[model samples]
Target: MGYMPTEMELIELGQNINMNLGGRVDFEDFVELMAPKLLAETAGMIGVKELKDAFKEFDMDGDGEITTEELRQAMNKLMGEHMSRREIDAIVKEADDNGDGTVDFEEFVRMMSR
Candidate 1:
């Protein structure tokens, strides 16, 4: 899944830009300003929300975080195989950017993005 801002989002952004600029921006200037701004906003949003949601599903304890055991169960269910502890450990280690021995939403997102 991906985050594509709706048409309404774009319209609201344009309205915001117009308001901030006192509604005096010419067409060419508006395009110049909005093009890069929209690109940056969308780029930042891409796959971030989806990855968070995916992490939530793996976080079976409802603790807003995922341990290797939780990930093992989730992957076992998804892949229909009893994955070894070493395999699960490798997955968590790769995703655990902070070396805190667990995967948080940010870590999960970063791993999925890669």
Candidate 2:
């Protein structure tokens, strides 16, 4: 069987993605927004459609947006681990556009498909 990724490796992977996204607001807002660095360490190295579907899954309220709480819960449920509240807030703040305190589909796509 393949080896499991360590927690530090996971955090580094997240940081790499966040960095490559350049803290953008949306994919259509500018060039290279979707040019995010892909990490092979992630589960099966998913594609854009799978990534978007994952984002939709995170939007548990079906509100077309993912709040920090929703992201936190999704992480816990899917990854079987709890993320710190601060980490969740940081992630939301990183992708939040229009300052609405949430990541919309555009932002989510831009962040993930990067």
Residue-level lDDT for 55 in candidate 2: 79
What total of clashing residue pairs does each candidate reach? 0, 1
Which residues of candidate 2, in runs, are more than 4 Å off?
1-48
Candidates' TM-scores? 0.57, 0.57
Candidate 2 residue 36 C-alpha distance from true site, Å: 15
Q: What is the lDDT of residue 63 in candidate 2?
A: 93
Clashing pairs in 1: none
Candidate 1, residue 4: Cα displacement in angstroms equals: 18
Residue pairs with backbone overlap in model 2: 36-114
Model 1, residue 90: what's the lDDT? Answer: 95
